[model samples]
Target chain A: MTDKTSAKVWENVPSPFCGIASDDLRIEVCGSSVRVLANGDAVTVPGFERPVTDTAPRIAGEPASLEDAVRRAAEILKEARLPVFSGFGTDVNDTRAALALIDKVRGIFDQARAAGGVRNLLALADSGWIATTLAEVKNRVEVLLVFGSDVEAAFPRFFERFVWNRETLFGQDPARREVICVGRAPSGDAAVSPDGRRPQVVECDPRHLPELAAALSALARGASLQAETVGGIPVVVLRGIVERLRRSSYSVVTWVAGQLDFAHADLTVQQVCQMVALLNKETRAAVLPLGGQDGDRTASQVCAWLTGYPTRVSFARGFPEYDPYLNDASRLLKDGEADALVWVSSLSPAPPPAAEVPTVVIGRSGMQFDEEPEVYIPVGVPGIDHAGHMYRCDNVVAMPLYALRDCGLTTAAAVLAAIEQSL
Target chain B: MTALSFTLKSPLRQRLDASPLVPDRLLGKSPKEIATLDLQYGNRRIAAADLFDIAGDDAESVRISGSPKLDFAGRGMTRGSLIIDGDAGAYVGMHMKGGRLCVSGSAGLYAACELKGGIVEICGNAGDLLGSALPGNKKGMSEGVVIVRGDAGDRVGDHMRRGSILIEGNAGMYLGARMTAGTIAVRGRIGACAGYAMKRGTLLVYGSPVSIGATFNDCGLHTLGFLPLLLKGYQGLNTCFSETRACRSRVRRLVGDLSVQGKGEILLVA
Candidate 1:
């Protein structure tokens, strides 16, 4: 099912489809890292193309394979739910990256289906969803359900922005509002409310999202929850939480940064959505699907503006298009199909080593250079070399760079400008 | 005033010992006025005119002519361009802001160090830290683009806050140490850490990763719409990034730098 090497033409590409570079294979080595990908047979790189060696396995002009990983996405997506964990087991830095990666992997199935190829696909269609900013959260959201996440680890300012502070609207401080945390494990982020009452804990295995939903439902219905207790909390506290949620004028259900996996989290997401819908029946409420590339939201926002979408796109038809699996870097790396690359970034000691293909680069100043590329372009950091803007974790507009570093290079805007001119 | 010119001299080492290169301050000085230096050769003071002949009178833009083997040609230029027609010295355009400087020939090490904002064009090859911050400083070229037709040495943009960087040729290593916000597109194959310690930034590539650390999780692929816009003017990208009209409806996201609180992302084509 991964072999997408049917030599499909670039034009008339359907929606929800990824693309391989066709018709033009001239590659330029940009100033960036080399990554290998392999999955679908859409494009073949005849060699290993590992980053450790120049003579590893490499085929210069082929697109990386992005197939062979949809099934695994079911498991990988499980990682998207632990943003509220206060332990040492977390491996990923940003939960959004994991979700985006899974979505891309899942996208392979959608693309295959679009091409009339048979594959199981997860339905992403959902009902209306509501969301709020971190600022409004302080005033409006008095009841917080820290489900499957660890705020202490994922968000440094979760308390400062969401919980502990006094708000003008909600008229409540941390002690007044109700904070409930439910996860597979305990969370330090779920500390006792400033009023000296310990936050209720329901330590059920996160995988049993259905059970959690049922518990919440039972509490909402004024019935005794089937489960006696969860996360070491008494059933009475569970009832109290539901009561508080019912009585609150405004409320919010927050997500952890990592719960991107659909296996266990899909039900959770639905439940949160459902809870929002249910809550709205009584009062104003919203859900905050927390976790995005911290500042990458800016890139996502700008990219969306440029290509009318976020994250990934292909330009085979002289226009822009998007497909998750077909464009994922990891899948491409496994596929080993990039002929050359223009790796753009500004957050490393040097470039990321990759397949022995020619490449180009755009990033912060003083980047180390390798001899594999045809060209290297040095750009400025957005705020430092050039003043640019970004979106905070909660989608808030963040402050621009306070000062510019001392040297040459412009901003991403210029690089885009140059790329436009080049095309 | 101080107008440095190396129109055609090779005694740069000896002459450089006697200079007071406050050219901007010497805006209204006479020809026979004074060209001094606050340099120390084993703890000794001298004059700048002793090296290459300083020219020009009232021009705000400083010019260093002649094929002089000068070092530190355009170090820390505040608001100007260094047009060197011949081989020059190190720290070219170091800490520059708002101006265009061109070096017609080859250059020494640490070409453009810690450039805050400006445009520096090195027609020839350059040394290390071409567009990076100085040692002990976490900020590199915060703004501006350094176009190097040749290869760069190493340690570029260490701890940059924001900006865009493009290397026309090749780079040594340690590209972006800890960039908070910005985009860097290398026109050529580069060294390691392309997106290492990135708090938030985008690193695109045409080739595969030579070596990837655990810091960046391998999220799958997703099509981004910004490619064509980024590939617009470059010839190579014209072919590699022809409009496909395909977009990644879903993308895999990797969260790393577990060592610190970071939502920085590094995306690659899957």
Candidate 2:
């Protein structure tokens, strides 16, 4: 650690850990230790304060040099017939490097949070959706309809930063904004208006979201239903919500894809998107699919720009081939189709999945594994040790991460590039 | 003439793109030439001779001793016949314009996807998106006949514009979902949300469905004249629906989904 007098304070620092990319963080960094000085929440504070550990590389739990570790990783991947590059929890540059490496190795690339993002992607692939960004939600949204998501739990400052802002460009009072929660209600009062108005909650089992979404869409299209209640919510109450959405000039429907955990959840997302599309005929409405934490949006955006498709892509056929179900990392590993696993997680200490194949992990410094992998390389956190670009949940803007300390740990991009060079 | 056959030397360690082995693509190639054809096995391209023991010479009729790793077995085949003796991987008959593709064992996801016109018969269970469109495509299986002797996973006829999918076993959730026009008949139980957001289609279920969507309004029971004709169309095929005892004209018709075009009908045999 450096001297206490050498502490450098950083203002307006953007966070790469949070899905929203919260930018107004005030942090103080002394040597390798960092602290969130102001404007920190439960998610961002712990993210910024994670202490660096295990700065050296290890091969089968034995201390090794960086060159040896990368060479070992490459040798293992080179011997495998089918390799899977999973746990893509890194920033943009890192993801690009990993994709390049995977392409060269002719392996499969899948993100850790791909299962959640695929819910939205499957719907988008079936019937495209119109979505909005954080700016639109902050300045233009008059009615916010959330579906089966506890917004505050995932995004701590979502309402505080966007919904309940001080002023808007359209001259609409932020306090007058209407909030409605369907299926799952908010655990906290973040959705409550400054004028002491609680958000209208229509509670029901999350599994029935598909039916409720269909009901709402039907009601919006002026169709009558024979059933008195759909998904345990009365039809009359759903009609009232539909009427409010129709009256509002700008309405935004949002859901955290990870929260909808049931099977075939993409159909529910499609129903919600279809509802938004119908509402757009007479008024302005768009769906906002959240959940970009752990660099999911960053990896997807980078992959799409380089490749025509999102994640679950394979280069085994000498070209980029995409099949969301066929290229699933977990299924491939479970089926013993993959002979090797290359796991990359730099933002958090989340360990890679336990696999029977030869595993190479390039993860956060403190990541612990149930069993020692074949190769392990401790990497630097993007915002903490190295500067990088990370896309927000909205997928419109990529925030620039600033390095707060000169930690000896290297970035994931550097390690992956080294491995590619060895290959 | 004996059909050209490719027998697997061993269980595949990596997925093999068997698309090049289709009849139209390998029509006039010599035995030596066919042996030298490069097949994609994982990251490396290996000769067909390395993985399979090629035999026989009838190019129009081809046979493959399939493994679960054999993918794209009959992709874009315009003519001739291709048969897999064992379980086939994903995209068993993707984009086939014409010809007959048969898989004697279970097939993986997206089987018969985007099939323009063909006869695809799977003797065993089929994975999800049986006759659905490729990712981002608007139409799925525009013209074809798909017969699955065993259960089919979710989204059986998703986005299908025109086709007939006959499943002799149970079907998973979202049967005939978002389909524009098609006829999907399942002889066994169906999962939830059948005919979801369907614009126009007919889903015939001989067994009771687990749950029907709220948007589908029950039209009560009716004696339909077209039911006998529809069942008769499958008479020559090796499907239980072709049996004389199964050709009942009386059924329960439910019209939905009001959420979309609301023209699709689910006929439950009474």
Q: Ten-residue segment with the worst summed lDDT in candidate 1 chain A?
A: A82-91
Go through the candidates in order and give each one's C-alpha lDDT.
0.44, 0.90
Model 1 lDDT per residue over B24-101, tens place: 434565555545534422112444455446666643556665233254555555554457776556566666666667
**Candidate 2 runs further than 4 Å off:** A1-5
Model 2, residue A174: C-alpha shift (Å) = 1.9
Clashes of each: 242, 0
lDDT of 2 by residue, B1-270 (tens): 789999999999778899999999889999999999999887788999999899999999999998888999999999999999999998899999899999999998889988888899999999999999887788988888999999999999988889899999999989998889989999999988889888898999989635788888889999888878888987777788888787865889898888885799999987
Compose the digit string of candidate 1's lDDT tens values, residues A21-83: 111221111122111232211121211111211111111222211111111222322221211
lDDT of candidate 2 over A60-177, digit per residue (tens): 9999999999999999988878899999778998999999999898899998889889889989988889899999999999999999899888888999999999999989899999
Winner by lDDT: 2
